[model samples]
Target: MYRILIVDDEPMIRKGLQKLVEQSELPIESLRTAENGVVALQRIKEERPDFVFTDIRMPKMDGLELCQHVAEMDADIQVVVISGYGDFEYAQKCVSYGVKEYLLKPVSVKGFKGVLEKLIRTKSKVSSESFIAVTLLEQWASRMEQAVWMLQDAELDLVLDEIQEELKTKHFKLNRVVDMLAEINTLLEQRLNARDVYVMQRDFDLAGAENEEAVWACFTAAIHGYLEELKAKRKGKLKDPVEEAKLYIESHLAEEVSLEEVADHIGLNPSYFSQLFKQSTQETFVQYRTRRRMEKAKKLLQQPQWRITDISGEVGYADHPHFTKTFKKYEGCLPSEYRQQMGIRA
Candidate 1:
């Protein structure tokens, strides 16, 4: 017998949500609604609902603020944020405030029901240790996905070790570990390009591993082999115009590199080269060059001997102010601030 609250500005949306919850098979004893966070906060204080489904934007005090307030008042109340595609990033921020789930706009009946069911199941179980284990496992899964995308072997190894340690510390069941491995396979499959047959074969091998140690060995080998394959493919394709263009960019990072210059150097039309570069590298020539320049700048920043202006010039930026601005936008901090934060003394 759990209480629930639905908060939204639109009357129709609020009513629709209420009807959906009513139709749900969850053991909700009572359900309530509020037009905005201000009103919702009052209802929450009075009713103390076990769960709240909220929309991100409203007239008075948006969903994020509401979530923050609710967190302070009641840490146990589960929050499900409803957001549109445009609000997706804002919705991700809600997770830190203990949002249990996010539902996009025009929420499907199935999605709604699934979220409600998970919440109901979790509420019925009162084990704090179980909750913490699930949280840690989910965090580890996210880190693993990031590591795979960045092609970071060391990071992937660290994350794998962390996952294994988490399982050992929590003493998770064998079935749970297998489920986590299945999830890892699924994530790797999503990140790996479809055309990578060798990596896909390795993925299959990893999935077929019979034991924990086998799974670990197979996964490590598979990922390492995949990265090696990517490197080999890049090297093998040196005759490719795109690869030549990339080489030209890398060699001319300290110069004012241009698309036309690289295209001409590789004996291709500028327009065609632009398309091929994007198709092969998944980034525009300008974007790729800028990224390379930023990477160089970061490496140079590590050396205390190099002045910020010198680093900017070395990265092909004549204007130090522009370089600083670009670096801040890319790395989320000023050059001096980043240097200080990274412990590189002047």
Candidate 2:
């Protein structure tokens, strides 16, 4: 069990840190909080937490002094500094006192979680190969997150190329590459609220990739395509009725969704909504819905646990035969056949 301390002048910051720590899956024995370094130092002496997350500036006994004191008292205690951009250089000086990581002000959840995961990996003494893999995964996840947010296509391509080069150097097996992709997806989902934004589907095949280079090329292409989709979605005009309607359709793919229902959901007339939807998406509402349903059905088919009948119902088909016909129309194969083709048990 790991004991932890959160020190900051702001009450809200302390509360936020406490909540994040409590919610984390890591094994935490106790969490202590303090408004300033003076209180934090006193609490540290009394409680002796294994880790300290502290702000650089405080009313009394700032973080630097507290770090020095903690270092003098016990070298085992790990310190993670939280500082504003202006104080970054000052925080860097705390490295000599053994500050483990530096988090900028207004910390992002991804960055916070990444730092904690890194610390946990360090304490557990993970194997060098595994450690390197984990570190690269986190770095790629972070860069991908930023690229998506900023809509930086060039940066995304650069990062993907860098990852490809590194994968070649490491000579990761196909299974290991697949596992890494899955882990990256998990991280992206956590950071991007992807569940609400888009449906993640395993619709690509990589079994033909026999070498590390081939595997990474296929993987990178898939990731690049997904990122481009996200970028396009983000580029859609803010508060665009067409985008909102698409979101409604995505969220209600399992339901008997109609143009009128979506129009009403977004406060638009049915005829007008139909026109705008077609104009914006370059497809009729029915066309878009069918494509989305087929895409979702394909995703569900990848899960071997879901039967064909269940998948039909999951994608809004009441009649199994109708689902099969529609899936074949869109995919040139039945759902089960598609699954089998992907080497997934049907």
- lDDT (10s digit) by residue, model 2, range 1-346: 7779999999999888887786677889888999888898778655566679999999878999899888776334678999999999999989888787999988777778788877777755522554245777888888877786666767877887786677557654344465566677667556656546665442345543444555565565555545545644666734777888889999998899989999888765465466557756899899999999998998888888889999899899999999999999999987888988989877
**Which parts of model 2 are misplaced by more than 4 Å?**
126-346
Q: State candidate 2's TM-score.
A: 0.36
lDDT of each: 0.75, 0.76
Each prediction's TM-score versus the true structure: 0.37, 0.36
TM-score of 1: 0.37
lDDT of 1 at 183: 66
Task: Please provide the root mean square deviation of candidate 2 (C-alpha atoms, Å).
Answer: 20.3
Q: After superposition, how far is residue 306 of candidate 2 from its true place, in Å?
A: 99
- The clash tally of candidate 2 reads 0
